[model samples]
Target: MSRRLVILRHARAEHGFAGPDHDRSLTESGRAQALEAGRRLALAGLVPDHVICSTATRTRQTLDGVLAELPARPSVEFEESAYAADLDTAFALINAADPDVGTLLLVGHNPTMADLASAFIDDPGLVSFPPASLAVVDLEVEWLYAAPGTGDGRILDGEGQVGKGEG
Candidate 1:
């Protein structure tokens, strides 16, 4: 089977509306949105093999929200490198991923997430990543070779705030 990369932009943050960039936390609404996204992912049977998150407070909290909605714990890694990573840095992270991880869940901020998605999502009609959104990109290679701009992926399915069986 082909490996997959599931890119998730963290849910809305307090900084998005009320604080400085680096120290922001997830608002109550942001947590709920993140849980909603998680529930949707669970319902769709799209849980990843592992979950990697940025150490940024917003993404850390977002990972918690996602984990709260799942049946069991997914292995997690909090990477300092993921924070403020540009496209090339992000690409290196993705391309050096473990090959056995059939699916990798990356919870991070925008620009990086959007930039990575844009580089590979083959659908001309698929663009835009609202907060708490999930993008399941189907790939045809090992996880370690799935570079940002060189991936062969298509947007398989997309959803938000979906209840069980609703998507």
Candidate 2:
């Protein structure tokens, strides 16, 4: 079966917050960006059936903002391992996603988010996952079989522009 994977980086966060890095909250602009991102995803018809998010303050806030713009609320898993995960770790998390979900969203930090997106596309250079940016990839495999360079990915910004890989 074909599946859609949405990889999103958390929005811009407060840099000088008097808290741990993981506890930093999103700034005003980040909140706006997160909302825009949700609208973009909706516009592209990529609403997720499940969400696997990092257990970080900024990521959680971003998810909330994105969810606010969506019509349906999908099941969510808050994963601590995604907070500062590398490519392999992120892959492991994604591999563990529920097989019944047709579309899955992974909200977390970068360059892990960017790296994960890059790994799935034909051209890694086509990926540019800045804050609040997301990439929607269509993979012809089960969730457990997800791997690098196995999908056709298109990166999207909050403005809804699509950046496709050169397959």
Best by lDDT: 2
RMSD, one per candidate, in order: 4.0, 2.1
Per-residue lDDT of model 1, residues 1-167, tens digit only: 67778778899887554555767888899999888877877876778888878898889888888888877677788888899888887767777777778778888888788777777765556556678767666676776667654555433244433221111
**Stretches of candidate 2 above 4 Å error?**
158-161, 165-167
Q: What is the C-alpha lDDT of each candidate?
A: 0.74, 0.87
Off by over 4 Å in 1: 16-20, 148-167
Per-candidate TM-score against the hidden true structure: 0.84, 0.93
lDDT for each residue of candidate 2 in 43-118, tens digit (9 for 90 to 100):
7777899999999999999999999988888999999999989999998998898889999999999889888888
Q: Give the TM-score of candidate 2.
A: 0.93
What's each prediction's clash count? 0, 0
lDDT (C-alpha) at residue 131 in model 2: 91
